[model samples]
Target: MVCVFSFFITSCEQNETIEAPQTTTKVAKKRLFKAAKAAVSKSKRTPSTSNNNHAAKRIASIDCFAYVFPITIKNGEEETVINSKEELADYYDAVEIGSEPEIVFPITIKLEDNSEETITNLEELDDVYDSCMGEETPCYTLNYPLSLVQEDFTTNTSNETVINSEIELHTFIDMAFDKDENAHITFKYPLELTLSDGSISTIENDDDFDAIDSYCYNYDDCEDYDEFDCFEVQFPIKANLNGEEITINSNDDLEEYISKLEDYTFPDFVFPIDIKYTDDTLVTLNSLEELEDAFDDCFYEEDDDTICFDITYPINLVKNEDTENTVTVNNDQEFDAYLDSLIEDDYLYIGYPLTVILQDGTKKTIADDDEFIALEESCDN
Candidate 1:
C-alpha cells in the first residue's frame, strides 16, 4: 500500500511538470494578446466593426481653390482691424480655413488607376472648402471655412506672395495629374511689388518636372490603338520620367489614360474585390484566433497565401509585408499628396498642408501625421 501511494504521488508530480510549460506559454500568450489589444486600441490601423467606422470610411469630398486676404471682416466687408501676421495666425489657426487671404487653386482629380488609391484626406481638410450645399452628388457647400491654423502664412496657399528680405526662399509646387497637355492650370499670383522685382524667379508649368522619378507603372499594350505609328508631331509630355524609360506592355489598358486628354474620353469603370483566407504562412495575420471570413475584398493580388502587393500612388505602387506604414510618391514635387492613403466613403478631395519646393525642384514625401504640422510650425512667426 505504501509503495502504491508513493508511485501515485510520483505520477502526479510528473503530470504537473508536464503541464508547467504549457501553462507558462499560455500565460505569456495571454500577456502578449493583451499587449497587442492595447497597442491596436491606440493605433489607426486597428480595424473595427463599429457602424461609425463604416460611415466614417465612406469617401466624400471635392477640391477647390481659395484666395486669402490680409484684411479682416466682421460681416462681409473688409476690416482693417486685424492685418498683422501674428493676429492672422491666431484667427485662422485652423489649417482648413483661411483667416488670411490666399489664391486658392482648384483641381479636379480623375483616378486613372482602376484599383482604389491609398491616399486619405482628413476631415479637417474638408472644412477648407465645399463644392455645393445640397443632397445632390458632391455636396459639401461653398463658403465652407478653409483654413490651416497650424501652418505659417507663407506656406498657406491663399497667402499672397511674400518676398523674404532676410533669406532667399526657393520653393517648388508639385502638381500631379494625368500626363495630358490639356490638363494645364493657370492662376495669377497676387504678388506684392517687392517680389515682382526681387530675383526673377522661375515658374515651372512643364510636366517633365524632374528626373528623380520614384514611380514605375507597368501595363500591357492595347491592340486597339495604332502600333507605334504617329505622324511627325512632338507630343509635349514626356512618355516617362524616372530613371526607368517608358515601356508600354502589349495589351496595355492604361496607355490611353496617358494619351492626350484634350480628345480622349475615359470610361467610368469599377473594380470589384473578393475576400478569402490566406494561410498564416503566406499572408501573416496577428493573433492566434484565425480570422473567419478572414478578409475584406482585396484587389489584384491573388493567391491568398501570397502577400497582396498593390500600388497606392502613381503607377504600380507596391505594398510590402511588416514594414512601416508609409505612402511614397514620386520625388518630383515639394508638395504632392500622391502617397496619402485616402480612405473615404464620400467624394475624394485635396488640401494643401505644408510646402517647401526646392530650387532644383526635388519633391519630398511628408507622411500624413503631426510631423507635417511640426514642419509648418517652424516657418510661423
Candidate 2:
C-alpha cells in the first residue's frame, strides 16, 4: 500500500514544472568606525629619532644677518644709517668725505636687537666703521659745518689770529704786543705748553709770565748794549762801594783801601788799587811807592826836570814781618826754585805774609795753601 502512494506522488511531481524565485538586488554595507580607528592608531605611534635631531640642529644654528642691524653714523644732530650699498653711498655724499677733517663729533651706534652703543668722537666712530667695512684706514669727512669757541689775542691793526697750536700761540703774542706796546701781560690762569718731544711746561703764575714777557721785549736791546762797559762803570775811580762813593787820593789812601778789601776772601784776593774808567780804561799800580810816584807825576806835570821815578820794577818780593829784608827777583829760574822750596817745606802753613809781583806788574799776596799750590804749579809749568 505504501509503494502505490509514493508512485502516485512521483507521477504528480513529474507532471508539475519547478520554477526559480525572483527578488531585488542589494550591496554589502561598509564598516562606519574603520577610518576613526585607523586615525587613533596613527596618533599613538612614536616620532622618529632622525626627525628630532633635525629639529635640534635647526634650533642651535645662529642667524648673523638677523641679529646684526645697520649701523647709524651720527654727528651732532645729523644722523644716517649705513645698511645697503646705496645707503652708504648716500651717506658719503651727504657728509662730503675727504682726506682730513678737523672737528669731530660724538656718534651713536644702534643694533637690530634694540641695543645701542655710543662712540666718544668721530675718530673712534671712524675706526669702528672702517674696521667693520674691512677698510685699511679711517675715512674722514670734509667741510662739515662745525661751530667752535675761539679765544683770540691779537691787535686791531694786525691780522686775526686763532690759538690752535704752539706756533700760533707765539704769533698771538707778537700781535698782542704790537697792539699795545706798553701793555703788561699777566697770566691769571695756568697755561700749559707741550713741546714736540711730549714734554709739558706749565706757566703757573703771573710772575713767571711777566718775566718771560720782559725777556722777550728786552732781548734785542740787551744784545745791542755793550757788556764790557759794565765792568768799567762798576769799578770807576770814585765808584759806588755799597752805595757810597769812595775817594782814593794818594798812596796812603790806596793802602787803607787795600787793607779793607772785603769783596774777596783768601786765595782769591781782589785788590782795591785798580780803577776802571767809563772808557774801558784800566789803571793799576803794583805798590804804594808806585802809586805815590804816579800821584807825584800827575801833580807835577809841567816839571819835566823834577827827576820822576818812571822805572817799572819787573818783580818785587814783599815779606810781612821782615819788610826791610824784602828783595826783588829778576831771574825767572831763581823765582821758580824759591817757589819749589816753599812748596816742599809747606811754608804756606805758617802765618807769614809772602807776596810776589806778576809779569803784568800786579802784586798778589799768597794767603793760603791754594795760592801757594797755584804758584807752585804755575812755576812748574
Candidate 3:
C-alpha cells in the first residue's frame, strides 16, 4: 500500500509539471499574435510617404502672357503647364544663371510731304528738332503730317507732328499708338505766340487742342493763318480696320466701319469692338456696360440754354457665339434695355481681358482684378 501511494503522488507531480509548460506556451503565443496585429493596425493608420512629398515634386515654373493660359519653363525650355505667377518667379530665380538683353523695335517716320526717314534707335529721335533748325522747313515748325512705323505693330501709327521734344517722342512711343489712326495732339508746354489781332497771346501749354482740331478737321471753313491759339490739322481722320482704311466723322461712318467686322467670331468673354480714339488711342470694349458708360460720357443734349455737340457713334454687340452674331447699337434705348436684361440673367459679367494702349504708348494687359479696377478708375477720370 505504501508503494502504491508513492507512485500515485509521483504521477500527479509529473502531470502538473507537463501542464505548467503547456499553459505558458499558449499564453506566449497569444501575446505574440496580439503584438503583431497591433503593429499592423498602427502601420495602416499612418499617412503615406508619397503624399507627404507631393509639394517637393512641384519644382517647375510657368509664365502667362495676356492671361492666355500659362507655359512652363523647365531647364531653360518652355513647357506647357498650369502654374501660378509666384511659383514661376520662384523657379526662374532659382535656375536662371544670367540675364538676356531686351530686344528693341526699329522705327521709321513718314512726313506728309512724302519725306521718309528711318530711325534705328531711340537716340536718333532726340536731336531731330536741333538737326533741322536752320533748314527751309524746320522740324519744330512742322505740323503732324507724320506717321510712324515700327517693327512692333503696337507702336506703328499716324501721330501728330507736334511731338518735337525727346520726352514727348518717348512718351508717344510708349503709348503704343495703333497703326493708321488719327491721334489728337494736346500741348503740354507753352508756345511763344501772337494772336490774329496782332497782340501777344495769353494761351499756354497744357491746353486741349480738341476744339481747335474739331473746327479744322471737320469743317473746311478754317481761315488761313500762320499759327492759331491752339493746334489744328486739316488732314482727314481715318482708322485701319484689319487692312482696310475707313474715314470716320459721324455715326453713319462708324456704323459702316463696324459693318466690316460682321464675319469674324470672337470668344464669348471678348468685347468685339475695337475703338480708335480721336487721339489715336486704342481700346477694346469688353462689355456692353462699358460701352454704354463710355457713350454716356461722349454725348450731350442740346437745349435753348446750351448747344450740345453731336458725339454719337455706333457700337458693335455680341449677341451669340456665331459669326452672324454681330449687331450695332446706336443710341437705342431698346438695345440698352436688352443688354441690361442679359446682365441681369447672368449671361454677361462686367469683366474681360482689357488690352489698353496707355498714354505713354505702352501696351498694358489688364485681366486681373486689381488691374481691372485701376482701368475703371482711369475711365472715370
Best by lDDT: 2
lDDT of 3 by residue, 278-369 (tens): 56666666564454343323321111112111212243344322336545545435344434334111121212243445555666665544
**For each candidate, what is the lDDT?**
0.23, 0.31, 0.30
**Global lDDT of model 1:** 0.23
Best of the two (1, 2) by TM-score: 1
Q: Sorted on lDDT, highest at the top, how do the candidates line up?
A: 2, 3, 1
Residue range 115-180, candidate 1, lDDT tens digits: 222212323223332222224432111121211111122233332222121110100011101122
Q: Clash totals for all models, in order?
A: 55, 0, 11
Which one is best on TM-score? 1
Candidate 2 residue lDDT tens string, 94-140:
33322121222344454322245666755554444444445433121
Candidate 1, residue 130: how far the Cα is off, in Å = 24
Error of 1 at 305 (Å): 3.9
Q: Which residue runs of candidate 1 sit more than 4 Å off their true CA positions?
A: 1-203, 212-254, 262-381
All candidates: CA RMSD in angstroms?
A: 27.4, 58.3, 41.0
